[model samples]
Target: MKVVVDTNKCQDHGQCVFAAPDVFRLDEAGRLAYVSGPDESLRADVEDAADVCPLQAITLED
Candidate 1:
């Protein structure tokens, strides 16, 4: 699966990190960082991250 997060829309609140730590995280500067192509086994968690993003910045492309 392909995961995309609109960084312009993201506020770096780390909600995606909480929802899917394996695919999302905060960098040393505390900005949002993520895996653009995560394993399929993490699809559900990725979807959850998309759902929980208050800014609605996360998107999934298959």
Candidate 2:
């Protein structure tokens, strides 16, 4: 699975972080950081993250 977060649309609100901590996180600078290519096992969690993103910044690709 592949994940992409649109930084321009993201507000650094950490919604994705809560939904999928393994794939999304806040860096030391408090900026949004994420794994572009996450394990397939984490697809469900990543999808949940994308669903919960208020800005709809998360996109998933097979």
Candidate 3:
């Protein structure tokens, strides 16, 4: 699966990090960072992360 986060809408919120630590995180500058393509096994977690994002900046694609 592919993960996309819209930086313009993201506000450095770490919800995605908690929901999917293996795929998303905060950089040293406290900005949002993530793996664009993660293993298929992680789809559920990635979906949860997208659901929890307060700004709804996360997108998933096959």
The residue-by-residue lDDT of candidate 1 on 1-62, one tens digit each, is 99989978999989889999999999999999899999999999999999999999999999
Q: How would you encode candidate 3's per-residue C-alpha lDDT over 1-62 as one tens digit per residue?
A: 88989988999889999999999999999988889999999999999999999999999999
Query: How many clashes in each structure?
Result: 0, 0, 0
Best by lDDT: 1
Clashing pairs in 2: none
Whole-structure CA lDDT of model 2 = 0.93
Alpha-carbon RMSD of each model: 0.6, 0.7, 0.6
Give Cα distance to truth, residue 1, candidate 2, Å: 1.0
Give the Cα error of residue 17 in candidate 2, in Å: 0.7
- Two-way lDDT contest, 1 vs 3, winner: 1
Report, for every candidate in turn, its global Cα lDDT versus the true structure.
Answer: 0.95, 0.93, 0.95
Angstrom error at residue 29, model 1 = 1.5
lDDT tens digits, residue span 1-62, model 2 = 88988889999989889999999999998999999999999999999999999999999999
Error of 3 at 60 (Å): 0.5
